[model samples]
Target: MKKWCDNAALLTLHGNTVGMVSKEFVVSAPGKIILHGEHAVVYGKLAVAAALSLRTTLHIKTIHDKDDVLLHLPDIGVEVGWSVPEIAAAVALPVCDPEKPAPPSEELLQKLKTFASIPHDSADTKTLALVSFLYLYCAIVGSQKTLTPLEIRIESKLPVSAGLGSSAAYSVCLAASLLLHKNLISASGKWSEKDLQLINAWAFQAEKVIHGKPSGIDNSVSTYGHAVSFTKGSEPVILSQVPSIRILLVNTKVPRSTKTLVESVKKKYDKSTVVMSAVMDTMEAVAKECLILFEKMYKGKADEYYKQLEELIYINQQQLDIIGVSHIALEKVIQITKANGLCSKLTGAGGGGCAFALIRPDVPKETLDCVIQQLSLEGFDCWETGIGAEGVTLHV
Candidate 1:
């Protein structure tokens, strides 16, 4: 890949004097929801996802006189530090190259687990978070012999392991901030396409540490922001023309295992390949039809457009139920929203995690508030936010 940096003067000022200059800044990236195509995406079907208004923000400060890197994640009640020299000594060879990105090697990962005191069999959020930070820090900033000691604090509005792309958002923020600190990317205005790609690549590597084998949709949406149409083994098609739509993001709060849910679907597919294949085809059609409707809705924001969109959502939800991913809580959410004259569907790998309800433009504020009140009474957390919001951004 081509290296895209700001001018040489800016590089000389920031890149050459790493420890001499103290830097402080913030970067943020949005969480994501799979608007359509949940289990079927595993079968190489097309899927749609959008950036959420809920974001993960990172506050970074360079500690010029210190020799340790500190990470504070208040959301998970984690505060830890590692000696820079110790990390440098532990990894004698470079593991990360932003210009030529690759997956984290097993040897490097094992070293990180040992250095951080994480167990080899552990996959908890705190453990994964620490490993991701150490890996990114070593790979991105460790190359500089005069690496600056730093402190990074993360705060996220998105719930962890709720089928929202919270981890991806966090990773995107880390990549952007680290790249900015190294003067590998611009710190002003909007980041270029090349810069965003580099950030996305690094973030995807971090996602691998977290999710094991991510579909790349979460990091792509978090890094690029806005909405994207994705298919397995293909580049994401950014839907730039898709207009922002308000929705009720209802969290069931009942935890579900994505791995288990995916495996369950696979078993069903194996039992009856012909039946499951047809279902997958139908799900793909739903996604394609939704994509076309989204493009058309951009040109003319008519009631009919929304009507068709709601119908698609309804049909897609039925398909998800057919494949046996829907839960009682999710069905309850759908019924409650439907009673209020809105369309709803389960997002993500949903045995039960989150379901979003469409809030039409003509829907009265009082009606929306009532729906939220009713859902809150039923023990579900709901947020009124727009989809397709801006992606990873630097705060000035």
Candidate 2:
């Protein structure tokens, strides 16, 4: 609910007078973490996710003389440019309608992949990032007569492919910036509910391009900000009044496939239907209880609430292990954090992407420092950040 877009300037480009609007600005959106419920969410169970303080920012600068759009992702050392006319000529962009977002068809995706010169079998970060950018840019801009040529440079504090919703954050920023650039949304203070919903819809389309299939939770949190209680086939219940909480976000740096993890959990479930059903039910209960505690904590801070939250964290982590998604590296993180009087659980798809440890408000600095030092010595990356951060916003 803060205002950052107040400076507006007019410029003359190519002997033509341009509109009096800010042509250069920055837009940012926060990454997300699953505080409770990971694989269980796949089973139509409840899950809780929050927007992380770590965010992805996109700087958009319009170029009047240029005929191409440039995308530079310095964090990943990727730089790609596509000619505006060529993109228009090659891909058949559908009509622009934020209210009714359509997923990219296989034909459209294949055309883009070929146009971008990406290998057909390649689904790497760079490839997906490029495709997502092109898909959103073309879809949002549509067949407008004047296609704005711009340079977009990205910088992110969140780690890529770590199950921290980095891609979703990136997509949200793109949607917000493109909407602003086209003047489809207001450039004033906080965006209205209608505008935010539009942005979320477009961002979800981009997420489908980046990820084969995704729950709407990541983009919803990135667009709406704060915390959300989500279940499959239902709209995310936003927790607007939830207070921010400090935690240690640890990255195991061990790559794992989310599809594989989900399938593994399914195999376990199929092997023991009754037991796995109970495990999933318990996970859902953990999420439901955590949601209630979050609301109560927002009303008034209580030590008892924190204690109960930590207990839920422990229970959820144990459930994840029982479901066979936990790896040795994740267990090591849990062990390290528990030894230091903190409860930790693997976020996202588990099997060694990232884990978060609850850091109580009363925790001693020395204890926190020791935990960090030990985790660092073991080659794991850790950061002390808060959850329930603001969502996407335009910068001056």
CA lDDT, candidate 1, residue 334 = 96
Per-candidate RMSD vs. true structure? 5.6, 4.7
lDDT of every model, 2 decimals? 0.85, 0.85
lDDT tens readout by residue for model 2, 1-396: 111223344221111233334667788999999999888888999999999999998877777767888888878978778899898888765545645677877888888899999887776866887998888888777646346787887889999989888999999999998887776776663689988988999899899888778888899999988999988899999889887799999999999998999999999999999999999999999999998888888888656588899999999999999999998999999999999999999998988899999889899999999999999988999999989899998775
For residue 167, give model 1's deviation from the true position in Å: 0.3
Task: Please report the TM-score between candidate 2 and the true structure.
Answer: 0.92
Judge candidate 1 at residue 29 and give its lDDT: 95
Candidate 1: 10-residue stretch with minimal lDDT: 1-10
Runs of candidate 2 with Cα error greater than 4 angstroms are 1-20, 93-95
